[model samples]
Target: MPPADDIVYLDHLASTPLDRAVLEAMLPWLSATGAGNPHSGHRAGWRAADAVEAARAEVAALVGARPGEVVFTSGATEANNLALLGAVPEGWPVVVSAVEHPSVLEMLPELARRGHRTAVLPVDRDGRVDSADLAARLEAGPAFVSVMAANNEVGTIQPLDELAALCRACGALFHTDAVQALSTLKLDMRGQGIDLLSLSGHKLYGPQGIGALVLRDGLALRPAILGGGQQEGRRAGTLPVALCVGLGAACRLARQRRDGDAARLRLLRERLFGALSARLPGLRRNSPADGLPGCLNVTLPGLDAADLLLDLPDLALSTGSACAGGRGGPSHVLLAMGRTAEEAHGSLRFGLGRGTTEAEIDRAAERVAAAATSS
Candidate 1:
């Protein structure tokens, strides 16, 4: 790893550094004076509960959902688990895209074990879930469908509106893991026909360990974490006030800044892609043209991404999902997109974020070029 001060962090999909403003909002709750369990009824507890509810409203606003619909969880992983495992009833079918994050993909076995029939929806070469394939899957009468709003690996934005419509037509509840999409996409839970949605704080410059699942009004879910009947019995736990405050602050900022950030990041992403293409003529683009503004996945032909990244210590990049790291296998996303294992091994994912700059993009290009040529 590069020295902290010297590293060019291009792994925003893995996690983002907490925004200073978000931290400021969290600090009061993190202090000793802020100690209070939101589940309690005393004065301090009431104050904590108020803050948590306020944060819940903020998170709800980001997704255009009612405040009462938000159910806070540990993170998107937990949210995904809750949506997949809790929403679908026994003996009912559950379907998810092939390229879903591991949190969602890994639930198939458990869902199967719980007596729910699980199915995988195929994606196109650009990592998009084909609506036609989804339509066919819907014919099987899935009780619930979980598709991501945007992919974390290739950054491909799925057609959630269309997918949700198809699910609605089939009378199947739809859920989306919007953890990566919230940074650039505008989400309206009601307008999109999204029955459930999942998001994480750290993906968007908020504190880690804080996330929420937004359920459509009147939708019911079985409790995944049973405890004190918090969150109206949908989820049960002592809410983390500090993390909730940070997530709310981040969501508020995201609503205000996403459009401007998307425009700026798109140009920077193109700049980096142009720079890299000019340097390495044979590199293959993996991310689609209309994907996330700051995501650029590419295959450096004839080179292993792990080896390449090892040589460029100052440039923080990844071969695939952070969750899939150290698993000793090729990217399941690439394989799902029909790329060979060798091509998956040669792939690199560049995730620019709020802090990325043109100069850093150029320098990263130069470093990657040098490393690729030498290899």
Candidate 2:
């Protein structure tokens, strides 16, 4: 493997490196002096609780939600599980997009087993759900809908405002798995009509092992985990103070720098695509023009992406979501977007991030172009 500096990483969708500021904010909580549990009744406990609440407020501010509305969980997977399993009444109808992450897609079987009426809404070639399809589904009365704000693989941004509006018209609750959207997009939970939003710390340059579910004020869900009754019994567990602090710091930094970061990333992403297309004219862009700023997905027809990735050890890239990569299958997201199995296997996802630069993009583009032509 190449040294970290030698490798041009284009897999931010898998995970982002921890930010320096986020680490600084978490250092105190990771130290012995920061050992007090928030549930305890003492000076140390009070201080810990204060730190947690402050972090909570920071997270809330980034997404235009109240501090109390954010309920911390182990990560976005747990948050998704909680949002879907806990929010929907038993035997109630629930809907999700065909391109959702495995965390959300895997819920269908369990939901069906538990007697919930479950359905999947399809996406277009650009990986966008048709609001009319959702409107048709919502005609069944109030149902819980889980659509990601942006796709993890293609980085396609969904029409949140329109989808939320459709759901509202029929009294449906709209939930978005926003783990991949927070850093690149300005999210307004209430304004966007998002009833429940799931987020992960690692996806936004924070520490792993922490995520949150932002619930619309006054919305209630059944308890997913039962214990000492924490977070007003919405989620029950001892909060990891350091992780929470890291997530909070990340959210604060994202709020402060999101616009600038998005603009820069957009330029870098386009540069990479342009360079590759110039060299490999046969390259087909799988990512939409209006997708996430840092993401670019393309298919080099007749070449297998998995094999291409194996040859380019110095470049960090992916054939699909890291979570699903180990499962040895063509990407479900691409398949859902109407790609043939061959096209899906030929696709590669480039996820640029805060550290990506023009030089790195150029270098990566050359390397990829060379590899494709040779293959």
Candidate 3:
């Protein structure tokens, strides 16, 4: 029943293929332009710096932030770490969602070691943080609150405006990891009242090894990495001019194609889900109905997700969080949403991207249904 021996990548949630336009934009900075450190004051260095600034502006424009507010980082993980650790005032608590990414979860142990109180707000079955419960937790006083813009595993979009309003009322800083949501969803930093936001280049069809953190004006965050005066001394290092340019070009392209892409992906996603459900009547969709257009998380009764994935090599997918894929653990996102360990283990995430086609989705759906039925 499954297709034979041909690979069709459907794991966009893990990472996306780089756009040709983005690659073309980056080609000039990689070698032809001259190797000059962005921190240096020489002519070539200034040229590189100018390109970095232009990229910064493009990234800022994507999320409605000023260029000065964007701080380059290695990736969204680093950006999240910087935003959380750097922005938290001394003696204040930190509150993060229970379904946060592993980077945020792992940081809690260290924060506890440093004598910072940390609380994890629980989510509903839909994988959304309960605003009322979050408010209750924050009643203790000022604390930095971080909730991701969207759930990576489940693709559930968070109510950022409500969360930001709550943080503002509690006089606390708010941060969002927008890595999974960026370009897929339209965002306005000012309108949402978000103090900090993190984005990764790879998630938006750009190069890896680069990301940006947008900070609210006048918000002073202590520098975690100290050295040369790059990134306005916020994040210290030579800027990756080529990767930055790629990110900028990717952002511009994403903006141009977002509406049409979303519509197309949504149709394909529905078709895929419908096909799978029709074939396996007991199949359950894990992601929320109103979630992001391109992502779908589903579970088939009596099937081991890892085994199913292994059997269907033609259809690339994930058992749960890509970060925790090989570890053989129940998904924390599902557990946070009140699913049992068995249900969590049976779930798989299918993330559609700009390159995904109707034929590919159909083939993938057939493979998934075959796997589920066979198991």
Candidate 4:
């Protein structure tokens, strides 16, 4: 294993370094040759519009959705807000999983203020939602249900198909925040029965500030943002041509390399886990063994995760959700999975990426184990 001073990064869940191919694809759009405005009928504008449409088709292909169904948003947060707020009628009840991102959690207050009922479905010790409980809630008639395809903190893959079926049986719409699952899993929008799906570009080796919401046809909801007519009036703003191009290219690359990437990442993850567990006998893995391919959360009992992170500057990692960074609180996801406050506070998340190598994983495990023991 290499020395800890090498500065290996393993926080891909927080964000990924942009792929070179994606960056090159976006470069023309950022320059004068790119479309100035997609709305214009002029040659430059039409060319830009053509680029945007091409990217849209690429994004749609990755998820098995039509180009028309993909609505560009600022990121997954905006996409989630659009999906959740747009799908329901005024004053209807809503249900979301307990382990959802703060964007979804924060929206509950506004929904309540608007006289809409909200229910948070709980998860088991493994951080998986109870389908029976979800079905029961749906039977009570919520307008829609939101569940993440995979957890960001603990990396538990939800039974999206079963949940979608339950929502369908009750005639409710189903949405998934697939920001963390985009490159890690195979996404089939129609096959999964997902009425709405949110994805972030930065999470999949694309540029930030761009994402998309895939909505089923004829699903009506009010627009969250109102401005110049864009994105077919579902979302209103000037399209981000460069970011869109990057996202589309990243999606295409991911589709091409998904199987090979998953196999390599799984091997790296297991080796890291096995090495760390052997070095530190009391170490516990927070993520499920069968969860997403490249994410792992582990708890080192009696060690403060924040302290461990700060002490190990050579390793870039996270205590839990990067969205909760600077908040100084235990992970809500870990708590939902039955971890004690101390246990939750003792956790760290290691998210592997395309650039991560087996040697890097081994070195990271050794450094992490050393940090845990010293702390």
Candidate 5:
């Protein structure tokens, strides 16, 4: 079914291939003259700085933020740490969803060490955060609540607007790890009551290791990385102009094509699932009907996820977050939803993206089904 055993990338949730348009936009910055240090004061630096600012503007527009509010980072992980540590005072209570990304979930130990009490909001069977439980937690008075806009593995979109309103009523700041929501959802930071947001470029068809933290106006952060006082002294590092350009271009294209792309991806996902489910008996879908259109999580009860990968080498997929790749453990996301270890380990996540094609989907489905039936 696959054309010449070509590798089909179904792991877009982990990372996407860089877009050609983004590459073209970044080429200028890769040139010799375009390689000036953004911190330098000379003409070269000014030109490099201009490119970075233009990129910043584009990323800001993507999330309905002002250019001045965006802070460049190595990636979403750093951005998340900055937002959480900056807004949440030591000894203040903080609440986060149980299925949050490791970037958010891993903060608990450090926060505990700092004397900040942490409470986890549990998710329903559908992987949606419990709004009523959140209300009960707010009674304890939290300094902030960190909930993701969408789950990276299950693609379940959270009721962020409602959550934000609840946080506001409780006089608590709200932060969202929106790395997976970009390009697939309309993000209006202020209108959505999001005090802080984290994003990644690679997840949106841009360069890896480059992301931004969009902060609300008048929000201040203690510098997580101290150096020569760059990025208004909030973060100090020599900015990468080419990567910024790529991220900007990616954001621009994603904003322009989001609606159409979402519709197309949804159709492709259905087609893939339809084809595979018809062939593979006992197939179970983990993602819900209201999940993100770009992602599908499913389990073939008797098939081992590792064995599935071994059987179909041409289709790139994963059991869970690529960040945990090779760790050989059950997905915490699935486990938190009450899946047994067997079911959790049997799951595979299909993350469709902009360049995904019907042909590719058909090939992937056929291969997956054949493997499932034969295995």
Candidate 6:
């Protein structure tokens, strides 16, 4: 690994550093928490419950949903499990996009095992699913459709509004994993006809171990955890006051800074690309033109991204999704987008966030270009 001070992080998609404001909001709840177990009947419990509900309202407002619709959970993985496994019926037909995060993709197998029919909606080379295909699939009237607001690996923003409208017309519920899009997109669930939305706080400068599944009013999901009756019996657990406060603060900040931050990130991304392109030959950009401004996925012909990352330890980057960790393999999203196996191996994902600076992008590009070419 390179020297610690020289390291530049380009993997915000995996996780973001906690915002100082968010930490400040959470400090009271974490330390001398006058708020006790939210489930209890005492005054302290009432205080805790109020804080949790306020946080829930903040999250709901961020996504344009009612406060009652948001059910807090451990993280997006659990939120996804609650959406797919908890909402879909035993023998219903479900349509899911091919390039979704593993949280949404992996749930299909369990749905299939439970006798629910599963259909994978394919994407074009740019990793976008045509609305015509979605309309045709909804003609069969599947139980629900799950598409992401933006892909985690390539940052391709899907046509979620059209897909949600199609599902609504067919009387099918629409679920979206908006964890990646929360920081970059203005997600109005009502306007988009989205019935459910999944979120993870760590994706947007909030705390880890906190997420939410937002369901439409009057819609009930089978709870993954069954114990004390909580969340109107839709989900049962004691909510963590500190993490909830952090997530809410982060959501508020995201809502406040989205557009300006996106423009800044886009400019920095272009600079990184330009700098690297000047030095590194045969660089192929896998990210689409309409992709999120913050994420840049590029492929360097003949250079294994894993090997390059190992060689350039000064930069914190990714070969694929962080869920793949250091195991080293082709990205499912890249393969779904029609990249060959070798192309996938050579691809690297660079995620930029609010903390990212022009200086870091320049340094990272210079170092990465030198390292990749030399390797």
Query: On residues 1-375, what C-alpha lDDT tens digit does candidate 5 reach at each position?
Result: 567448898999999889999998988888886779978999999988998999999999999899999999989999998888766865778899989988889988988888888889888877899778888988878567899998999899999999988888877888999999887888899788889999999988999989999988888788888878998988888999999889999999889988898898899888888987888868999988778888999988967888788988788898899876767888888988888899988999999999899999998888888888787
Query: In angstroms, how far off is 251's CA in candidate 4?
Result: 0.8
CA RMSD per model (angstroms): 1.0, 0.9, 1.9, 2.0, 1.7, 1.3
Instruction: List ranges where model 5 is wrong by over 4 Å.
Output: 1-5
Each model's total of backbone clashes: 0, 0, 0, 0, 0, 0
Error in Å for residue 344 of model 2: 0.6
Which window of ten consecutive residues has the lowest lDDT sum in model 5?
1-10
> What TM-score does each of the candidates earn?
0.98, 0.98, 0.97, 0.97, 0.97, 0.97
Candidate 1: count of backbone clashes, pairs at least 3 residues apart or interchain: 0
Q: What is the lDDT of residue 94 in candidate 2?
A: 90
Off by over 4 Å in 6: 2-5
Give the clashing pairs for model 1.
none
Q: What would the per-residue lDDT of candidate 6 be over residues 184-292, giving only the tens digit for each residue? A: 7899999889999999999989999999999898776788899988889988878888999889999999999999988888898888888888888689988886788
Least accurate 10 contiguous residues by lDDT in model 4: 1-10
Better of 2 and 6 by lDDT: 2
lDDT of each: 0.92, 0.93, 0.87, 0.89, 0.88, 0.89
TM-score of 5: 0.97
Q: In lDDT terms, which candidate is top? A: 2
The sequence of per-residue lDDT tens digits that candidate 3 reaches over residues 1-375 is 345436787889889889999998988887865587777889998888888899999998999899999998999999988987788888789999998988788888888887899999989999998789878988888788899999899899999999999999989899999998886798889888999999999999999888989999999988889998677779887788899889989888888888888888888889889988888889998988789888999987777888888888678798877777767789999988988889988888999999888889888888788777777
Model 1 lDDT-worst window of ten = 134-143
Deviation from native of the Cα of residue 153 in model 5, angstroms: 0.6
Task: Give per-residue lDDT, candidate 2, residue 326.
Answer: 91
Instruction: Estimate candidate 4's RMSD in Å.
Output: 2.0
- Over 1-375, each residue of candidate 4 has an lDDT whose tens digit, in order, gives 437557798999999999999999999888877748987888888988898999999999998899999999999999999887787777678899999999898899988888889999999988999999988887667568899999998889999999998888778889999999879689898888889999999999999999999999898857898988788789888898899999999999989988888888898889989999999999898899999889899999898989887777888899988888877889999998899999999898999999998888988888888877887
